[model samples]
Target: MRVDGLQDLATITRQLREQRERAEAEEKARREAAARLEAERQLFSRAVGQVHPLTDRNLAELPTTPPEPLPLQHWLDEERVLMESISDDFDVSSLLDTDDQLSFRRPGIGVEITRRLRSGHWSIQRQLDLHGLRVDEAREALGEFIRHAHKLGVRCVRVVHGKGLGSPGKSPVLKGRVQSWLVQKKEVLAFVQARPIDGGAGALLVLLQPARSA
Candidate 1:
């Protein structure tokens, strides 16, 4: 008698054979699609190769066009005119007034800070030496250095302007200039002549105001 629910071996074999046939058909379709795509690529390549190639003469005969001038030229010209109109005079005596040792503090700032700076109370975080630089170069360097130090929240710094022994008459030209520049900067809270161990009269210890949180 036949079983109520179980399939016979012949029925299972037939089902497997049908599944294998379906898989083979799908594989054959995929191969045909790939072959068609390769043929189309070959046709496109041949068409591209038939187009004319350009020679050196064709490239050489092309128009020689200059790039457009920058729009900043107008602004630079205006700046030049403005600079030319300004006077090139200042009170030399005011800039050169440092009595025995270099020192200065802005209004409302205590003299104790300058004393502490001179006595090496603060650790020197950075130093800039203006030994061989020209006046213009020194000024630019000093301004940039101070601004950068202020931005980085640096509190104490040293500036070595040198004794200027090589200058004519052995006068310390940069020393006075540095003192003048430091006083003018808003970031400079106080400055004093360095001690003997810190370059003495040749260098200065500067105290910078802490950068305000933005």
Candidate 2:
């Protein structure tokens, strides 16, 4: 009976030692984890420096989309006005000077200008061909071309009305109308029949007024 009692005491002592060792190991691990956490906090603070959170009042909400654009209504209105300004009914016979080659000069412009234009004195800087376009299309295209050329400070240009060889009964349809249109435009200073080498009777040499300084 004494021997069994001693063996029981030995077992109890061994169990107590194992429990104490386990408790110490757990405490060591907790300390190591706490040290690592403290080191990480110090490193983050050093890297980032100090920061302040933004207040809600300082924030701005960005728009998801942009504003709508403007329509080209004004340009269309100007085009309509331009179309109405020129007319085929305007008589140009009185305005043209009777010479070997027909020519026109705006009133107040010297006759020498028309003579020079007829003689190809000014270099042709631009040209517009109304060969295949209908009457209305030709007028609109001619108006835009003249305006654009004058705006760019072009002094000389050519307008090819195609000599009417292909028209009904072989008559030039756009020639007289084109002359009337040119006379109506204030930008035209003078215009004369092109020389034989420059489309001959099929075209007119036109001189434009110098663009006004802005």
Best by lDDT: 2
RMSD of each candidate relative to the true structure: 10.6, 11.2
State the local distance difference test value for candidate 1: 0.81
Span of 10 residues, lowest total lDDT, candidate 1:
84-93
Cα-based lDDT for every prediction:
0.81, 0.90
Q: What are the per-residue Cα lDDT tens digits for candidate 1 across 1-214? A: 3634456666777888999999999999999999999999899788777766566544455458877778898999778545533221333345322657747877788778777887789999999999999987897788779988999999999999999899999999888778767776778888888999999989989999999999
Query: Residue 139 of model 1: what lDDT?
Result: 79
- Candidate 1 Cα deviation (angstroms), residue 151: 0.5
In candidate 1, which residue ranges exceed 4 Å CA deviation? 1-99
Top candidate, metric TM-score: 2
Give the 10-residue window scoring lowest on summed lDDT in candidate 2: 1-10
Can you tell me which runs of candidate 2 are displaced by over 4 Å? 1-80
Q: List model 2 lDDT by residue over 75-150, tens digit each.
A: 8988767665788789999998888766899889889888778787999999999999999999989998998999
lDDT for model 2: 0.90
Q: Pairs clashing in candidate 2?
A: 164-172
